[model samples]
Target: MEQVFFNEAAQDLKTIHDLLRWSVTCFSAANLWYGHGTDNAWDEAVQLVFPALYLPIDSQRDMCSGRLTYSERKRVIKLIQRRINERIPVSYLTNKSWFCGQEFYVDKRVVIPRSPIGELISQEFAGLISDKPQKILDMCTGSGCIAISCSLVFPESKIDAVDISEDALAITKKNICRHGVKKNVTPILSDLFSNMPHKHYDLIIANPPYVNVKDLKSLPHEYLHEPRLGLITGDNSLTLVLRILGSLKDYLAFHGIFICEVGNSMSDLITQFPDIPFTWIEFDQGGDGVFMMTKEQIIDMINLYPIFNV
Candidate 1:
């Protein structure tokens, strides 16, 4: 197909489509909104752009091929332009994202699912945590991805999904049903262990909003589309992580472990708690600051190592 160009006199949909197809290949659909442009050297290549990565044209919906006619290309280009003008994430443009080999519906209601928790589940933290867990607690379980993944890997284990926002919980519930894991995964609306802890958890996993003030202040345009409440926390974002870790002991069963992903603040946490042992979990995925500690670990740290308490 020949490349097309935009015309101001009268909109030429065909010409616009050709230009967009040419333009899209030179740069990523996500990168198209950014500051730079790319040279048209690479071959026209396209892959599964996520279920949520919607094509910009209605004419191309049923067709899976990347080839877009002139008019079709123009429609998609217009959509991208609109989103760029509005500063919306292209993920939201498609309404889907892939996490742990599963396609999940995502919107501005919650943050996109990106965490080491998925990798940890694949490793079966159930087996790695020293004590085998029969019950799991997924705190701040947005979209229920963590809880749903946990329930699948640990069939015999029961999971409690806790979140503060009701709308987020609704999305999570839908995912749980989508995967048919409702029997083992329970959704509860609690502001961090408020409704639970009368019961004990064998393992507690959390991927809270630990992005510090600096990151939050200047997050990428794509991230701006997510609910800010789920990203920015405190001046350092350590306050919520600390409060959550401090509260874990009360709900954890004896020898139970707690895993929390604090993003880039793991070093900061280590400096803050020099005495308490933080078994930071290593990961291949691009996630850091996932620290693990058992109830016993916290008990000793609180009683004997008060200097380490943040």
Candidate 2:
């Protein structure tokens, strides 16, 4: 792809600047919510196609406004208009989203990588690696973003990414190849732990479908674009969570840790168990619905598992 370029400014051309000013005016009128954002998502969109971008408003310092010829100015306005019309997230249109300050590929097939897990992995589990896991399992690894981040952070550890869908696994493969971690991150098409080999994983991590049926249906448009199988849980999100909590102890090695992201289901998990002690993890970036437990903890807390008809 050619780097977007800007022609030399026309000293005598007032028409170009006038058109651009009106274009931004129209963009602000149509996309005020996005225009006013700190990241300036709309302004960024304008800059992508219109490299000679400069606006007079709120940009009192560096690189905010400039002159774009008619064609360049027209392109940026149309792009922002397309975003407003389609309701597709600007992130998808850009084919990128920030995770742990690193840009990653994302599309409608996979959920955008927003889990705080990325931030956690950046600090190498926040120096939480008293016992370095030899083998790691990423359950329901949709786009394999988590697996790729883990492999990058822990260069010596091997990773296994499991999911039931071939489409998701295919994307996972793409990311593995993109990040060049194919040798370290293995992909498995499995329903939970059903198809996984009974190997002892030092750390088993999951960001499974914990959104209850009703809750899943009401997610925002950006989230609706993602695959529901990895986000929705049936018969209450408890079904899948309990299944993992019950069977995880069997698959984890002694001193092994199990990390699961249950999101809103954390409240439900607590109400149901009443006494199940789960370690809620905090991320440097924003995220919720994640909890941690050990193999010994799982064994001791085994009685709290709810036997649901999954």
Candidate 3:
């Protein structure tokens, strides 16, 4: 890739479209990772440019042709430089991320909200859940996006958003308040379900740190900016997952649904527990490594073996 040179003398580079194009070029040249919130240079460019210019991401194409002011140009250039050089995720740069069609404030303190669990929340867990969840638990909730989304989806439900990191819980509180779901969503400091042994939920959703030790070392530079506690698990990436499964039955309602995203550890999960029935969820919007199981299914598995003996 040729080095992207930003030329101030170029007259054609005055418009938003020009800056966006230049950003895309620079991002591609730098080989920046886009798995944070976007999957490609173009989308990442849009995310960087649109937010910097105070424009909506879905703004009209004609708006892109609008000329950028001198200050706007400088700001966009600086952002692009940091993006390329620091390998920071655009969401962290902008301090904002969108999940389940809702916007939430984000920073390095919490992982960017990119969980596929959002797809299930958007559908209100249709096929998997029959009744409207009265109690919800967003275990390992980073920015509390899942819990906040659930509060909106199930207006009558009260949600507990738990995270072991106080910093993450602080951010989660801000997001819950930002989304105006503070009344229904509570941020709790807990290492999984440790702080809520007696509490139970009708629906429990988690996007835990399932990245294996080996994969963690090989993650792109952009991912390195995120908190390690929110990504790495163990050698096989099933340490925390197994712990969650072991204690899940005790905290789930009679007909509760437990949904979790194990990322690349899905294969390991299947291999480790071949007898357990794990319903891998498919998303039309594009995401994988998530699975769902009902309370009854968990109970049956517990009965068959001492799976939950941990």
Candidate 4:
């Protein structure tokens, strides 16, 4: 293979600033889609370059002009090539992802943690849930990101991180240990609520698989790297989500809050049960299709839409 020169002026990219600039140009030219923790080429480049160089992501102020060793240049270049040629997400390449301001180990075994529920967790689910939850449930917990984040926010609360995929649960357990929440956050192998212990949770949050058949087919290459089980909900995209709704009331305690992310399937969900008054959360950092409903509302929904009465 021929050497790809990101900069025509220099035979080799030397400084951190040089590599950062070059990566942005290559990423922009590749027309790569960003969404796995970053939204633009510049941010994506910074994520790739800084981590590859063993520097802080926020260290651009002091290290932008710092020179890179020959070996360091090679590592950064190789990661850049993979980012462009293979279209792998930077998080997967680095085996790291950040959620709610904390880092977690990640790879192809689990989907990268990018849920907006982090914002709500940081806010202690304020104005939505009247009190700090004593028991929290994270359904479809891919990397245990939500469950672990909840553990940090609610140190006194116990959390159950449930996922159907054993492979995903392995990653979840690793993250659990990584964050040292073994006492509070417990990983469970369950298909929704099918295997869940008969316990009521004060807060239940899920970033479930909501990609329908149509969107799944057209997803970018970056998404292809994530586990299919974590992304595709069903043919109509509501299969898993509907199942969650059906059993959630059984496990959700009185005055509890239920939050789930359907992404672009929000319209389909609304159409399926038009009468249910779902409270859609508005994230200031930019994400949509996450709906919240109290336990009372969920019971009301079950009454109105008997199809969910399973």
Candidate 5:
């Protein structure tokens, strides 16, 4: 269908609300997927429009009447075109995404931060954690949102953010500085725990690429904009996850807790190691497939699963 207001010779859209409504209509008509950060057309429109106008996302209703300058209108239209035509995620277009209620710089170099692990961090691990962690590790710390958010919650904890992709680490470094948690969060270029220093973490968290090959192929166009290395695992979707589990015992403190977000791979993971018990975490806000385990539990299961090489 031809977009009415987004076409040439169109001049009716003028106010912020007008453009937002038009964008929502355009997005819905285009059948755009909204899994990256939003779940519907209206929220996606606000994500695109509010940042484009340099206004707060929760701005007052009166601000919607403010008129957009010609340049601003052109810029908004261009962004909308990119969203509908190119299928780029809004965060990549705006170079930002919010996680755990804090904003972080983002781009195609890294996956957008939308992990449910943020929920765990916001609650500071609550009942799962017995004591304050002095050291933490965020494996596959894309954009460093997990590590940065941890720093905010545990100000005294030292965080090591590790990623194999140098480009992703570069983005993580930028976010670490952006959040002003430089001293506490350290970015490391490591594939899992290979290059990480010999140190034990009281808590280790990962939001690794757990999408199986099949699922990766069927992801929406918006997800295609992200780095595939940050999403696609091997056929079983446990390639990286198993590797992490293999080395977890060596890096986790005796009482340390491990949290990993495996997305839809939870069922496959359970099937692979049915003898081992994993605490499937549920978020009140919404999100699933994340599991938590204690170091002692992993040690006990290591012998039962050959993946741990016990």
Candidate 6:
């Protein structure tokens, strides 16, 4: 039984190193999927164990040999078990996630912040937008990570973090407060641009649901813990994305740029709009299916594809 293993681990696992090793072994044996924050059992073990012990993620190697208190060991054991049994991502377990080298609060209400858009933000969206944006929009801003990160990068800019789900907006507000971007980041409850202000934005970013029905059904168990509202992009997958593209020109300034992540729906987007020129961004840090386009391009695309002119 799990209780027996807990007792044995509590008795036999003498130090952080022992517990970390045990966690890695258990995770590997369970064949847990690791895509939220970490990719391997060892790193996943460290993420779960170090945080449970209130130890710094960058704690020295010597600290691994240090003994853990009974309570600390028990907490780590329970978290590890929950991760394996529930197939929850480590960030959700810890209520923490990182983007653009900054930490944010997250839970089941929002998908864990792992968008490749962080790399683009870290570079200040260089070469994409010619000038500093005075206004920005983060569509489908779940945890408000993208909007908060942009606010930090462009403190002078006013940002709108829009999400249809009130629960998600709550998380977004929590993150906005956590990151101290309350002055610039405003959370709005809207289905895409339905309730957005009439003014146009100098920059627009989105990480909307783009998982196709086929891919959704085959996703790893760990992904099942994330909200369906934040993952499924309708049965055809391009439904929400097409709507975004259709209405994007209304919100994007003349010189502004639009960025979005469609994940595996990249093919669907291309198939649906073959002539639209979308510049797919390549990240050195590693992610795909994110693309960037300018306001002019969206206008042109709409002109060519009138069906997208909603």
Best by lDDT: 5
lDDT of 2 by residue, 105-184 (tens): 66677766667677677877755558667899998887788888888888899999998988888888988898899899
Give me the runs in candidate 4 sitting further than 4 Å from their true place: 1-11
| Local lDDT at 284 for model 6 | 91
What TM-score would every model get versus the actual structure?
A: 0.79, 0.78, 0.94, 0.96, 0.96, 0.96
Worst 10 residues of 4 by lDDT: 1-10
Off by over 4 Å in 2: 1-76, 304-310
lDDT of each: 0.68, 0.69, 0.86, 0.88, 0.89, 0.88
Of 3 and 5, the candidate ranking higher by TM-score:
5
> Which order, best to worst by TM-score?
5, 6, 4, 3, 1, 2
Q: How well is each residue in 1-310 modelled by candidate 3, as lDDT tens digits?
A: 2224443513347988888888888888888888977899999999888888788889948698798777778777878878887888999888879999998889889989998888888898889888899999999999899999999999999999999999999999898878888889988898888888587789998888988889978888889999888878767688898788878888999878899999888898888889988999889989899998988888787777675664
Cα lDDT of model 4 by residue, 1-310, tens digit: 1354632313477799988898888889889999899999999999888988777788998999998877788888888888888899999888888899998989999999998888998888888888889999999999999999999999999999999999999999999998999999999998888889999999999888988778978989799999989988667798988888888878999878899998889998999888888999999888989999988898888888868765
lDDT: the better of candidates 5 and 6: 5
lDDT of 3 at 260: 90
Q: Candidate 5, after superposition: displacement of residue 165 in Å? A: 0.6
Model 1 whole-model lDDT (C-alpha atoms): 0.68
lDDT (Cα, tens digit) per residue for candidate 6, span 1-310 = 2678777888778899999899889999888897987778998888778777877777949698898788888888889888888888999888877789887888999999999999999999987877889999999999999999999999999999999999999999888888888999999999998988888999999899988778877999999889999988767788888889899888898888899999878887899889888999999998899999988899899899868755
Clashes of each: 6, 6, 0, 0, 0, 0
Model 5: per-residue Cα lDDT over 61-102, one tens digit each: 868999888788888888898899899989988887999999
Any idea what lDDT model 2 has? 0.69
Clashing pairs in 4: none
In model 5, which range of ten residues has the least summed lDDT?
A: 1-10
Better of 2 and 5 by TM-score: 5
Q: Local error of candidate 3 at 304, Å?
A: 3.7
